[model samples]
Target chain A: MKGVGPTTPAASQPPLLEKEGRSSRGAVRAEVLLWLAQRASAAVLGIAVLIHLATMSYAVRGGISAAEILARTRGSLGWLLFYGVFVLAVAVHVPIGLRTIAQEWAGWRGAGLDVIVVAIAFALLALGWRAVWAVCA
Target chain B: MNRAWRARNHPAYWAFLVHRLSGLALAVFLPAHFLVLGQALRGEAGLEGALRWTDSPLVKVAEIAIVVLLAAHLTGGVRMLALEFLPWRDWQKSLAALAAGATVLFGLAFALALVGGG
Candidate 1:
C-alpha cells in the first residue's frame, strides 16, 4: 500500500517525463501540419495557375480590351469564385514558401520572421481579393 | 567563378535557381498586376487607357517573359512536390530534366499562341 500511495516516488517521475515528451511531440506535430498545409496549397495552385494562364491566353487572342475583359468577368459568379479560390491558395502558399527561403537564403528565423511572413500573407490576400472583386464584381 | 561555372552546367542546380528567381520575379510582378486590375474600378475609360498602354511592343515581349517565368516556377514547384511526397527512387534524379522540358514546352506554346498562325 505504501508503494501505491500518492506520495510514492515512482508515481511522481512519469508525469515529468510525460510533460517533456508531450512538448516535443506537439512541436513536431505543428511543424508537420505547416508542411502539409503548404504542400496542399501548392497542389491547388498548380491547377489554378494552369486555368488562369489558359484563360488569359484565349482572352488575349483577338486583342480584347480591358473593358471587354471586365464586361465578361463582371457579374459572373463563376469567375468570382474561381479567382477567390486562386487568391486564397496563393495567400496560403506564398508566405510559407517564403519563410523557407528567408531562413535558408537570408538566415532569418524565429518569431519575428514568422510575423513578417504572416503580414505578407495578409497583404497578398487583401490585394488579390480586391483585384478579383474589381474585375468580377 | 568556379562554383558558378559548375552550377551552370548542373541541371538540378539550374532548376533550383530558376525556381527561386522566378518566384522572386513573380512576387515583384504581382503588385503591378493587381494595380492594373484595379483600374477596372475606375470605369471603362480609365481601364481602356491602361490597357492601351500595355499594347506597346515592349509590354508584349514582357508578357511573354512573364509567362515563361510562371511556367518555370510552376514546373519547379511540381518537381519539389514530387520529391517531398514520393518515395525515393532512381527516377527522382530525372525530375530536373522533366521539369525543365515541361517549362520549355510551356514557353513555346505561349509564344505560338501570342504570334498566331503563319
Candidate 2:
C-alpha cells in the first residue's frame, strides 16, 4: 500500500482497498494459528514416531503375538504417557494437515470445512485416548 | 502450455506428493488402528482375534505398506521442518533425496523384523 505518490503511481490500483486488506489479514490470522500448531505438533511427532518405529523394528524378532505385546504394554504407566502424548499430537497434527489438503485438492474452504476438521480432531483424541486407556487400565 | 506438470516435476514436488499421500493413507488407517488396539480392553481373546485377522498374506503386505507410508511421512515431515527452519543452501535441496532414502531403509528394516519375527 505504500509508494503511491502522484509521480510513483506505476500500476493499476484497486480503489479503497485499505479496509478490505486489513480484514483479509485478520481472517488469515486463524490460518496462521493453525499453521503454528501443526509445526509444533510435527516436532513432537518427529521424536515420537522415531521412537515408535525403532521400538517396533527392533522388538519384533520372531513374529508378533498379542500376549507379548500385552505383557510389555499392559499396566505400564510409562507407555501410557508416551502414547498419550503421541495421540494428542496426532489429534492436532492430522486434522490440520487434512484441512490444508482439502483446501488444496478439493477446493473446499470456509467455516463448514473448519467445523468438520474440528470434529476430526475430537474423534482422533477420543479414539487415541481410548486405545491408551485399554492398554494402561 | 501444460505448465502445471512442468512445475510439479521436481524433487520437491515429488516429496510433497509423497508426504501428502502418505499422510492421507495414514489418516485413513488411524481409526481402524485405534479400534484394533483398543481390543486390549477385552483381554487376551479379543486381542488374539484381531491378531489372527491380520495373519492373512494380504494383511502382511498391507502391514509392510503401512510401515513404508509411515516412514515416508515421518522422513518427509522432518525434511519439511528443516526446510522451514534452517537457512537455505544448495545442499538443503538434497534433503528430499535423503528423506526418501531413509524411508526405504525404515521400510526395509521393518520388513526384515517382520520376516524374522514371523
Candidate 3:
C-alpha cells in the first residue's frame, strides 16, 4: 500500500524503499522532520542551559565546593540523563546544521559531509562525556 | 541602494543578520564564562570572588541583553526554518510578523524577570 500511486509500473515491481533514493515526497517529509528535530532539540538545549546557569549561580552563591558539587552529582540519574540527552542532542543537531553551511559554503556533500558530521559528533560526545565524568564521577 | 533597503526589510534577511550577531555575542561570552568558572579550580574564595564580580549591575545588564539576543535569534531561526521548509508559504508573512512580536515580548519578559531578580 506504500507509494502505490499511478506511477506503479506493474504489480510485480519492487517497493519504493528498494529503490536507490527515497521518493521526492518522502525526501521532503524527511527534511521537514529533520528540521523539526533540530528545532525541538535546540529548544530543549535552551531550557537546559537556563537551568544550568541558574543552578551554577546558586551553587557559587551558597559557596558549594567543587567536591561538594561532585558529591551531589555522583550516581544521580537525573543529572546523568539530563546531560546525556544534552550531549546527544548537541551531537545530532550541531553537525546536521553545520552540514547545511558546509554544503552552501564549501560545496561539500554526500560521503564527505557524512564523514565530517560523524567526526564532529564523536568529538563533541567525547568532550561532553569527559566533562560529565569530571562532575559525575 | 533601494535593493539594499528592500533586503533589509525582508524578515528572513533580518533574521540571518540577528543570528550572526547573537552567535558572535555568545562566542565572546562563553570565554568569560569558562574563565569565571575556572576560578573554581583555584579555591573557594577565588570562585566566590568571581561570583561577586558577577553581582555587578553591568554584568547583569549584559547578561540580560545576551538573553534577549538569544531569544530573538532563536525565534528568528525557527521562523526562518518554517518559511524555508514548510508547505505554508502563503502564511509565511503573517507567521513571521507574529514571530517577531513574540520575540520582542518574550525577550523583554525574560530579561526583566532575570535581570531584576539578579
Candidate 4:
C-alpha cells in the first residue's frame, strides 16, 4: 500500500491528505483478516510440516517405490484427512505470503493483486486436493 | 557495503534472510510439485513414472535440499509465532539461534536417513 502509484491532488487538498484517504476501511479489514489467517494457518502448518517431514524421511530411508507409497496411502481414510488438512492450510497460507512479497518486491498492491492471489489460493486448493485424492482416496 | 555486512552478522537478520529465501524457494517449488502430483489423477502409470524419475540421484539431492528449506522455514515460522503471541522477553534474541540449530538438526537427520543410517 505504501508505494501505490501517484494520486491526483484536489484544488483545495494537499497531496499527502489525498493519499491518506485512498485506503478504504474494507481494504484495511480485508488486510487484517488475511494477516490473521496467515498466522493461524502458519501455526497449523508448523505441526503438519513436522509430521510430513518425519514421515517422508522415514519412508524414503527404506527406498520406497511409487507403487509401494500408493499401496500404503491409497484407501486410507486417515491419510486422506491428514493430507486434506495439509493442502487446505497451504491454500490459506501461500497466497497471503505471496501477496506480501508481491507488494514489497514487485510493487504490486490493491484489489487487482488481491484478486489474483485469491485465484491462486483456489488453484492451490484444487491441485493439492486432487493430489491428496490421487494418493489417499 | 559496511552496513550490509554488519546486518549479515546479526543473528536476527540472518534468520530473516533465511526465512524469506527459503519461503520463496518453497513457493516456487510448490507449483511444480502440484503439477507433478497432478499425474496421480491420470492413474498408476503416470504417477509411477514421475516417482521413478525422482529416484535419480540428482533429484534425491534436491529432495534433501527441499527438506532443509522446509525445516528452516518451519523453525523460522515458529520463531515468528512466538514473537507474535508470547510475552516480550530478552530470551527472544536466542530464538534465531534456536531456529538455526533446529533447521540444521532436521537437515542432518534427513541426510543420515537417506544414507541408511540407523
Candidate 5:
C-alpha cells in the first residue's frame, strides 16, 4: 500500500520465547489479513477504474452537463450496484493503505490509531454511498 | 548518503513513490468529488450549478490533473499485481517505465478529448 515494504515485517521475527510468540501472533494475523484485503480490493478497483475512465472519457464529449450525467445514472440499477461494490472495496482498501503510510511516516500505531482508521473507513463508506444515492436516486 | 542513495534510486522505488502520492491525492479528492455529486440530491438546479462551475478553465486544468493522477495510481496498481502474481522476470523491472508512460498517455488522451470539445 504505502511503501510495498515487507508484507510480513513482524512475521519474519523468529519467536524466541512464548511471550514474543503470543504478542506477535495477533498483530501478524491482523496485518496479514489487512494486506490480503488491500490486494483483493486493488484487483476490484483496477477493473472499476478502467471502466470509469473509459465511460467518463466517452461521456464528456460535449462538455459535462448535469442532465447528461444524471440521465445515465438515475434509476439505473446497474450503476447503483456497480458503485455499491466499488465503495465497499474502497472502504476496505483505503484505510489499510493509509495505515501503512501513517506507520512509516508518522510512527502511529496501536489501538488508538486503529480505531481512528476504522472511523475513517466508515466515513468513506457513508460519503461514497451518499454519492451513489445522489446519482441513482 | 551514497549507499542510501544507491539503495533508493531504483525505478521501482520511484514507482512506489508515485503510487503512494497518487493514492493520497485521490483520497483527498474523493470527499470533494462526493460533495459535488451530492448536489444531485438537492435537485437538478443544484447539480446544474455545480456542473456549470466545473466548466471554468481552472477546473478543466484540475480535471486533467485528476485524470493523470488516476492513471498513475491505476497503472501502478496493475504493476503491483503483476509483480505479486506472475513469475519473476528481468523485464518486469521495465514495468515501472511502462506504467509511467501509460499514465502520461492516458492523461494526454483525456486532455485531447477535452480540447476537442469533450
Candidate 6:
C-alpha cells in the first residue's frame, strides 16, 4: 500500500472493488436471469415472427375471408398456444428492451423501471388476449 | 492498424453489415404491407383488389425473397448476439453455422408454403 498513495493516479481513480461493500448475490443472480430471459425471448421472436409473416402473406394473398380465418383459429388449441407463447415472449422481451431504452433515454432504473415495464407487459397481455378471444371464440 | 483492420474485416463484421441491410429491407416492406392490408378495411372489393396485386408473380417472388432475407438477418443477429454476450464463445462458429442452416431451410419451407407447396 506504500506506492498506492493519494497522489497516485490509480489511487485517485474510484476503486473497482469497494473497501467494505459489494452487490448482493441475489442482485447478481437477478441480472443474470434477466439476461437469459432476454436471450430466450429473442430466440422465440425470431421463429414466431417468420411464421407470423408467412401466415400474413398467405392470408392476404389467398383472399381468405375473416370468417374463414376465424374458423381456422377458433377453438384451435394450437393457434391459442402459439399466440399465447408469443404474448408471453413479448411480455418478457419488451421489458428487457425498455430496460435498455430507460437506461439510455430516461436514465432510469430501480423500482420505477420495473413498474413501468410491468405495466407495458400487462397492457400488451390484456390487449392481445382480447383480440385473440374475439377472433378465436 | 493491422489488428484493427482484421477486426473490422472479420466474419462478425460481415454479418453486422448484412443484418443492417436486411433490417432496412424489412422496414421498407413493412409500410407496403400495411398499405396493402389497409385495403381490407375499406371493403370486400378493396380487399380482393389487394389480393390481385399480391398474386402477381413479381410481387410473390419479391415478398418471398424479403422473407428469406429477413430470416437470414434475424437468425444471424441472434447468433452474433449470443457469441458476444453469452458465455459460449467456443461454440460461436458451430452455432452460427447452425443458425444459417436453419434460416435457409426454414425460409425455403415457408416460401414453398406460400405457393401451396413445391
TM-score of every candidate relative to the true structure: 0.84, 0.89, 0.56, 0.87, 0.90, 0.54
Expressed as tens digits, the lDDT of each residue in A2-102 for candidate 5 is 54455655544445555777879978999899999999999999999888888878887879888888999999999999998988988998898888999
List the candidate 2 regions with Cα displacement exceeding 4 Å: A1-26
Stretches of candidate 3 off by over 4 Å are A1-40, A43-76, A102-123, A130-137, B2-8, B23-52, B84-89
True contacts kept of each: 0.47, 0.80, 0.00, 0.51, 0.63, 0.04
State the weakest 10-residue window (summed lDDT) of model 2 chain A: A7-16
Q: What TM-score does model 4 score on chain A?
A: 0.81
RMSD of each: 4.0, 5.0, 7.7, 6.2, 8.5, 7.4
TM-score values for chain B across all models:
0.86, 0.94, 0.74, 0.89, 0.93, 0.80
lDDT of 3 by residue, A1-137 (tens): 87587666753455654563456667678668867887777767667755665564445443335555656676788887887777676666666677666676679877667787778768766666655544444
Per-residue lDDT, model 5, residue B71, is: 98
Write the residue-wise lDDT of candidate 4 on A33-125 in tens digits.
999999999988998999998988788776756787788888999999999999999999999999998999899978799899999999989
In candidate 3 the C-alpha lDDT for residue A41 amounts to 74
- First chain TM-score in every candidate? 0.81, 0.81, 0.66, 0.81, 0.83, 0.75
lDDT tens digits by residue: candidate 5, B58-100: 9999999999999999999999999999998886568998999
lDDT (tens digit, per residue) of candidate 1 on B79-114: 998887889777645998898888888877777776
Candidate 1 chain A weakest lDDT stretch, 10 residues: A55-64
Candidate whose TM-score is highest: 5
User: Per-residue lDDT of A1-137 in model 6, one digit per residue for the tens?
Assistant: 67677887666765654432355666678789988897788788778887886676566444445455655776788887887787677667666666765676578878778788778667766655554554444
Off by over 4 Å in 1: A1-27, B1-9
Cα deviation at B60, candidate 5, in Å, is: 0.8
Residue A11 accuracy (lDDT) in model 3:
39
- RMSD (CA, angstroms), candidate 1: 4.0
The alpha-carbon RMSD over the true interface for every model, in angstroms, is: 2.1, 1.4, 5.6, 1.8, 1.1, 6.1
Supply every candidate's count of residue pairs whose N, Cα or C atoms clash at under 3 angstroms: 0, 3, 0, 0, 1, 0
Maximum-DockQ candidate: 2
